[model samples]
Target: MDVSMARILVLTALAFAISGWAAEEKPMLFSPVSEEPEWRLLDSGQGRFTRQEFENRLGKIFDPTGAMQPYLLFDDGGVTLFRDKARTRPLYRLTFVPEGGAGEVNPPLLGGGDPARPLAGKVICLDPGHIGGDWADIEERTFRIGNDAPVVEGELNLRTSRRLAQTLEASGAKVVWTHDGFEPTTTLRPADLYPEAISYLLQGSLGARLPKYSANRLIRWNAELLFYRSAEIQARARRVNEELRPDLTLCIHYNAAPWPGGRVRLTSANGLVVFAHGSYTAEELAFDDQKFHLLRKLLENSTPVELGVGQAIGEQFQKQWGFRPENYEGSGYSHASGAGPYVWYRNLIANRMFDGPVVFVEGPYMNDRNIYPWIQAGEYEGVRVFAGKSRGNLFREYANQVAAGVIDYFRRQAESSATFTNYSP
Candidate 1:
């Protein structure tokens, strides 16, 4: 063979050899493809998973065009994945011990595993309030008490969380949740604020390290896994974003008040209102402002209530519902102007501690007699009707308006963060 031909053949063989070696060196947990497309479950925790299983999972998760799938996976421990643009970002890594196993299974490092690693991409944390049991306890069993009111708040929160998660996931965003369905509380109180509380919760031992506190000490204290045993939730959220620092953190929740006769309303007010914590700093205030802008827009679109009409609605509820709107102060009907436990809790944790933009939606009211029935029925579509009849749905046209606002915020963040080269179409 000619000298040039021989050299070209040798170079081609060397390239193939390097490619083979690189493939062999890569961790087995990650797909062979570097494009990192969205993956779907083929068998779903079924039979022995081999290379074929992996391929099938990939096929199911992705389309024939080989696009990344938007989905999340969580075992008993904390393990999450966000598939997009042919790459998977690890949200959290867990060491799982199989039943009767001698040792644990350490998730192989694929994208990244360090807890302090920057988030690979954007993340959405959905905090679904209450639980299914909360609904049964109130609606079915008729167990009414302090703080434990009805499960309506929890149910609505969970439903909306699920919907939002599904929507965001489809859009290629990593999503995690604080609670799925009333799991055992594993949160711990912080040692600094309540050393005794933390010690007591951990049985005199530090089960987990706490996140560093910034200006919001109450947020830090409340963030403890012990106070409400929400530490595990916080840890999971932190772990997933460790390597792939999320671009945003969203806490989904419904509003509630103590009054019995108020109707639904929206709020434009913004500030830090921590439930576990008492106050906030300038930075926290800025974050809350961004979140308020996002949430106010979202609620205006989702809820039938009209913007700048809370006072009008309050007046109408008193006249028509015959119950004082003031009485419904804590039942998810009042705006930010009114004080309630739910408001305090939502304002504190969601707005203060999260580094990214955060916001909470007071889904719907459960205390107002006219609104409570629809909520119990899980009939959000009926909300538009109620809003229209009551002049609250006049804001429906603003749905696109609010959605546009969120899109603009995200576009700005993307431009600044450079996290995604392009927004998902």
Candidate 2:
């Protein structure tokens, strides 16, 4: 067979492999397109915590719903974190220190930078979410009203990141980008992902969604989702974790609400919410990758830093934009961190995959009647009047608040002699 024909045959076999019909089962059991985790990497966390600390942290920040209980076996000596409820696969053995005993913890946000340049030695990685340019339509992050310029979320994110990076670098911080331009970080196109998408679909059932769309259309839709969401973010995560390895990573995004009647018009639902990577759902905790990341983030001691920075940005948002907190009261995937209106804890692909502290900021709702024109106005040179106050264009304002919050947090760190603390009885 020719190379093209052989490649098709391989993919056809792979589809069966994904469906579990093939003799050799794929190694990845959870989180499609994810590699099977090397469970040994969590070895360092042994004896790094106390039983109280472990339970407290989980109750407070990571798993509030007791989703992790099944996977953890607690005893006087330690807690054995398992890969499954059956406990056949052991992931880590964490020993508890005695009460008031010294548990090894890397203090978060030690105040050491030059007072003026609070971020002097810090490395910040900025991720402008989604691929715009020609990829905008495919990403589904672009929308428009009757005869108006398209409001593309990726465009807004890139603009905001550029301005934020400028401010951060001026404060003596080095700023890196996951991708500076619109091109995708992953080489895999939608066509290349068809087999995996097919496999993903087949997992649901042989009768999975051929009703809504034909087999080809359903496969195409799944291929696009995997391409944009799973594959795309995974590519960015590889860069953030492996290559950049910065002190902190910021994922910038613009929020949107469903337009009334599903029309492409504006609404009055603008608000703000920032995420600091916790709150793994019960369903999510069952996945191996989710469990691995939950512990990894906990072990890194990023909570205080994430909360501090998140609160700072939130303050800036209130002061500058005067928007109310974006409510996630009914949203099962997220919960308030008790830090402030703007800060919430939620597990997300970028935040979960990145190694260090991750601050995911979702700015003004795109479909807000009040903000739609501001978006249509695009990035302009001077302030524009919205709600009877002069405001920088949406891009600059978004960037400024984010940068200010970051700067404020670091400056507070620089002045204080104390390590950030989130532990409370």
Worst 10 residues of 1 by lDDT: 29-38
What is the alpha-carbon lDDT for the whole of candidate 2? 0.82
What residue runs in model 2 are displaced by over 4 Å at the alpha carbon? 1-28, 98-100, 205-211, 418-425
- For model 2, what is the alpha-carbon lDDT of residue 175? 97
TM-score for all models, in order of appearance: 0.36, 0.90
RMSD per candidate (Å) reads: 24.4, 5.0
Q: In model 2, what are the clashing residue pairs, if there are any?
A: 267-369
Q: How far is candidate 2 from the true structure (C-alpha RMSD, Å)?
A: 5.0
Candidate 1 lDDT, 1-425, residue by residue in tens? 24553454456447657767453333322111111211221112222223332333233211222322233344554224332222254422323334344331121111221122222244656565444453333222122335443444555555656666655564445777656775422343244434333222222122234434432342334334333323434444454345434444444444454333332332222111212111222222222132232222221121111111222223332343333222222433122333232222122433333333344433334444444434444433424454334322212211222222223334433344454435343
Regions of candidate 1 where Cα sits further than 4 Å from its true position: 1-121, 130-150, 185-244, 259-347, 379-384, 387-405, 412-425
Task: Give the Cα error of residue 326 in candidate 1, in Å.
Answer: 13
